[model samples]
Target: MTKTPPGLPLRDYAALGDGRTVALVAPNGRVDWLPLPNLDSVPVFARILDEETGGSVELVPREAYESSRRYVEKTNVLETTFTTASGVARVTDAMVTGVAGRLPWAEFARRVDGLEGSVEFTWRISPGTMLGTRSPWLDRVGEHTIIRCGQLSMAVVGSDHGPASSDPTSADPAELHGHFATTAGSRHLLVLTATEGEPLRVPDPAKVDEGIDRTIDSWLTWSDEFSYEGPWSEQVQRSALALKLLIHSPTGAIAAAATTSLPENPAGGKNWDYRFAWIRDLAYTAHSLTWFGLREETHAAISWLLRTIREQGPDVLVMYSLGGSTCAGVVEYDVPGWRGIGPVVTGNPAQGQLQLGIYGDLIAISRTYVDDGNLLDVETARLLAKVADKVCDEWRSRDAGMWELEDEQHYTSSKMGCWQALTDAIALADGAHINGDVARWRAERDRIHDWTDEHCWSEDLASYVMHPGSDRLDASVLLHAPSGFDRGERMSSTIDALTRELGAGHLLYRYSGVADEEHTFVACAFWRVSALACVGRHDEAVAAMGALVTQTNDVGLLAETVAAGDGAFWGNLPQGLSHLALINAALMIKDLAPKEAHDDQ
Candidate 1:
């Protein structure tokens, strides 16, 4: 087996998903990170983290090769072409989707077709167990090979020559392997099916080939529904597709990202598990989906989010597991982190932290739903009103800011978020969606506005500070401009201040003091684009939007963060918030463009 080169940039991987789970495929033809059976499931292949112990499925050329890859138009199917000295070949990878909804079985298929002279190809599957809970053993069941680890079982069925020799007792065990020489017009297919409870029947190779077409058709059909016809339309559609891959089909709970434990700062210690749902992320995603007229996905996500809020009641946590349960405590693994950044962790500890900003997220989602001509159900309306009341009561309290900072304060953005929540609640009440104390909400909302103006803004800094008594600038405040917090001179000046302080070209960090520590947050940069458009900085917004979209990988996927120096992606893959921000910013740019420019398109 070929050793994976150390320190592979996070941007080098492309993602594939069936709206259930995702797989990250590196440019070198390795399936580096995949959580089989479910998005939150323990990874069956996690070479993205610990390359030694964590397993991977590789399909690489024997000879030295140069590679290029792209997603098939209007779909998540990845086509990577390898050009070696002898010949060229293309590998198409996808997580097979069912005709209607998600398939009952988790399926990943790869097809290689030769386009030139004969090229030698090698492939292998290395099964891994989760956190050492169970031992994985390969058993040859009739004509197929089954890798079983605890409750999860994966059946490997494909067209290949045979298994290659490998050490059976090693930490990195290869369960199956094969090699073959292919010339022009040659075709090969590999399908991996996984199930949680029971073993899967070995699938026919021909049927797996058919499943590939069906999956492609499913993605194209979904993409066809997108109504965007504006500037950056292609990038917007790709971002929308990336966001769709993060949605859990059965539950409508979209994960923040696909992979977890990829550090925001590669130097060490900022890694986070993003394979779960956050209220803020889901709200942003729902709002973005609504812009494209994707009512089914929007309603599904809102319904799931509302149900989660209703279950948690007045004291809703900041985030939840993908299944809508409370987040598990953080558990550090001995597995070496991506690029040896160490202390890879599962689960988030921020669930217990008080984040008053989520109230705004919830209310924003409800307002979007109501504005779309859909009335909230009785339970949802009541839950939203209860959340609005909680926001009113807790607007003055110090809590974690939108960046989830450890040092709690009366964050300027958080206070403004409360103001937004209360104002939205008054609007909803006026619309008669829920019975609420609108008079009290209005008074508290005004109070928040007054407090923010008095304490958060700093004449010395010439803009809104991070929080009361601090002069740090935060990119999060830019979000308020488009939300209608202040569209006049103050907000326009805030945009300029953020551009001067937090901005690194078109990208911006989350806040002050972390520029050298973490990568620039991609969502924060997109927020700047929206703020610029709102404040009539049309040329700047267009230029900034162009730069931000170019930061995406070749396949048009953005991560949570990008390196400040080289524009390399650092955090989790295909972040939901990043994609949502991209969509929103693109829409804003199109909406704010001059009539002649829009008509020309």
Candidate 2:
């Protein structure tokens, strides 16, 4: 195993994806985590996980330097400027896409332009391990040098540096290395192209360089269509871009996060894989995408979800693979995790856990789509109608709640999920969008509301408990406040209780007992903002959201958890749910907050 450098904090890395796969780039110009061919595949660069064996495409200066970075306008393209004693160089990193969309083959381009005096730059390509299991071999095929690992083959083109051309004596050498000096106004291009299970081909470097601008333009053009003109507009757009990175364009499944097994706590074995699409996350993404008036992605995600649900109807898994198939069970990798945290995992085991809340989430998407004046096909309407019926049969059963907790209980939030599902279904039926037993749905909705109000409310805590008879408070209940179950005294008091119990300033832990295991959840904080708006705490909600947006990293990316004590990031990053929550909260605050009153003097 080749020795690798220390890993950077999650906050220092920015993501660049072509809507097919994402690459995490540190400020030091290293591509740390990139899954080849697709986002869920084995990573070609896993340096973030294992510093020793995990390989990276490293481009950095040899001398001492300092750096800063930002996205190029409204794009996922990352630009890092490195300044040294001799000069400065600006590096633009992109996972290039065609003008139409993602390319048939994977192409990652790094273009560096010197801005000042000449500065020496060094780079190395080390194909360390295929998802941290084995090493890849270096070979020269005809004119192009190839690195092969299992079914993946890659080549680096457009490097004129000396060592980049040197031949390797060993078939499995540690790395290919090189150095070049950049002068003012000089531009250098390095393109890494790969293919899986097919013949390898390389495009001209000049054309690949041209593709970078086209990719940036595509991102800008997509973002320009966003209709969000609310508070935190910049961060909301950044969150949208991050959410866009997680959407698998081909299948339209939104991944929960870009990487897996980033532990919520380093010492705790809570490193769950988040590569698969949780229907809950997909539903949230769909709702937020619709909120921003981005019609294409919203429709794509909704269509894919309903299509997949129809295929697995009468019973639905909590999660599915990016291909809309059953998830492969969990596999623990041999590689050490980031910072030597062990037991890195690949797949998720919660697919079979019955998260009853998905009924509400799934039905809500159809409601949003139909409410926007679009018509659902007969098949989708039937699928949702059946889901509502399934909710009738399943809501009484004790099952995993929205957190996918192991302990099954009569969760308040799950009941609220049923209530939301039935209420939406009743509305759809009233609108003639779906055919269902409207009277039955109405009765069940009322039953759920009555039962929840009776069993879940705590006289002492003044908020809904995590479950019946449990004294614990849950922040997830905030997700339902906007649905208007009560709109009066109970929800108002619950807001104060949640603020006192689960909140740390504007941030919030997931529930009562999780502070020891993880940090305050990013999405829960955003949910609190929405809940505040729903309950008429308009000024407080705006203030809380204003402070919450400050928690995002420099490039406006968020991880799953923000450490309650110190605000350090933990868990899987560029989290789609976190970004989705931010967008949704902004929209809610914009819609619900009162307009300024006119003054007549």
Q: Mind giving the per-residue lDDT tens digits that candidate 1 earns over 1-601? A: 9875575788888999987899999999999888878988888788788777677888999999999999889999999999999999999998987767688889889988889997898988887656444567876667655788777788776776345544678665547777877789988887788899875856687887888888888888888898998889999999999999999988889899998888887678888889889989998889888988998999989888888877876578888888888888998887887878866888987888888888898898899899999998888888878888888889989998887878989898999899999989999999999888889899999999999999999888789999888878988999898778887788888888888888788888888888878878999999999998888888889999988889988889899988878888888888988988999999998888777767777
RMSD per candidate (Å) reads 2.3, 2.7
| TM-score against native, each model | 0.96, 0.97
lDDT of each: 0.85, 0.87
Q: Give me the candidate number with maximum lDDT.
A: 2
The runs of at least 3 residues in candidate 2 whose Cα sits more than 4 Å from the true structure, single-residue gaps closed, are: 1-6, 159-174, 597-601
Candidate 1, 68: how far from true, in Å? 1.7
- The candidate 2 region of ten consecutive residues with least summed lDDT is 592-601
For candidate 1, give the lDDT.
0.85
In angstroms, how far off is 80's CA in candidate 1? Answer: 1.2
